[model samples]
Target: MEPIKILVVDNEEDQRRLIGIILTKFGYSVKTVSSAEAALKDMDSTNYQLIITDLIMPEMDGTELCERIKRKRPEAKVYALTGRVELYDDHKLEKFGFDGIIQKPISMNSLKETIESAVENIRRL
Candidate 1:
């Protein structure tokens, strides 16, 4: 069976690398992009099962990215990652169309559980 693929989008190079490394260690095929625009471009060729994007980005935020992705591929599972966790309320996140939210300074256990849940949900459908 093929390993589940994931895309990590973050403006910070360190953050992207860290996420990629962590997910890869967890037996996932991971790709990292510096911006939402680049991620959209990458999506053109890659069929990523999950996307985890930083909530605050310069040109295009994670919310916008999630919107665009959902428009193009409604089945796509996208998660929001934010350092300022309190800034995004549940309503806002639901309106933004995120499958889940990850607070920065990420908890590996939570990340794994969220991804597993998303994958399992997809499998069920």
Candidate 2:
């Protein structure tokens, strides 16, 4: 079976490393980027099955990144990852059309399940 390819975006190096470790353990191919701009540059060069990014970053927050990703690759699942519960509310994610979300300090199991469910839905679409 082919590994699921995921692009993980976070300004914090430690957080990005943790997510990468979890995803890699699940046998998925993961790429880590420090900024939304870096993620966009990589998107132009490579294809990804899903993109998991932080809601609050230095610039070009996750919502904008999600919008751009959806515009460029509508089929790819977009996830908003953050510790802030506020980002999950206000119906902003739905309005932005995010496929799913994973909270920050995410556990390996939770991350795996979220990714699996998101990928399944994308496959169905």
Candidate 3:
């Protein structure tokens, strides 16, 4: 089977590339974007089933991005990658259409498990 194609959106170059590297090591097709706008543009040409976006950004935040993406592709798995996980509630985030939240200073093992579960869930569907 083809590896899951994922799009990551983060304004921070270091964080974006780091995630790309990690996801690549996991043997997935990973694409990283520095802004939600760029992500949206990329989506116009790519069929990305999974996306990880920073919760905070310049013009458009992750919340808006998530809502827009969900509107366009409700089945897509879009997760929020943030350092301020404590600043928001899971229920609220879910209501806003986030599939999950991945906190900053991420744990590789946990991320791997989370992605594995998401991929498995996608495959099952």
Candidate 4:
């Protein structure tokens, strides 16, 4: 089987690298982008199976990125990472079309399981 291709989008370099390292350790093909705009540009170039992005970004936030990805590539899975969970409700997210959410400062275990679960769910769809 092909290794699952994942895109990690975050404003913080450390955060992007951390997520990339963790996902790469799990045998995923990970690409790290500094912003949602970069993510969008790369989305068409690479066939990413999933995108894990920070909610807050300089431009083209995670929600907008998710929307664009969903519109362009309906099968691409999206996971939002943010420190402010209260900024958006579950129903609001559903409207934006994100597959799931990951709170900031994620642990390896949770990050692994979340990615695994999201990838698995995408496979089933």
In terms of TM-score, which candidate is strongest?
3
List CA RMSD, all candidates. 1.0, 1.4, 0.7, 1.0
Best-fitting candidate, scored by lDDT: 3
Judge candidate 1 at residue 77 and give its lDDT.
Answer: 89
Can you tell me which runs of candidate 4 are displaced by over 4 Å?
none
Candidate 2 error regions (>4 Å): none
Q: Summarize candidate 3's per-residue lDDT along 45-103 as a digit string, tens digits.
A: 99898999999999999999999999998999999999997897799899999988888
- What's the best-to-worst order under TM-score? 3, 1, 4, 2
Instruction: Give the Cα-based TM-score of candidate 4 against the true structure.
Output: 0.95
Screening candidate 3 with a backbone cut-off below 3 angstroms (N, C-alpha, C), the clashing residue pairs are: none
Expressed as tens digits, the lDDT of each residue in 1-125 for candidate 4 is 88989999999999999999988989999999998889989987899989998888886888898999999999888889988989977778878998888888888998988888998887787
lDDT of 2 by residue, 44-100 (tens): 988898899999998799999999999999888888898996648747796886877
Of candidate 2, the 10-residue stretch with the lowest lDDT total is: 85-94
How does each model score on TM-score?
A: 0.95, 0.92, 0.97, 0.95
**How many backbone clashes can be found in candidate 2?**
0
**True-vs-predicted CA distance for residue 4, candidate 4, Å:** 0.4
For residues 1-125, write the lDDT of model 1, one tens digit per residue.
Answer: 68888999999998899889989998989999999999999999998889999999999999999999999888888999998888997678989899888888978898888888988887676
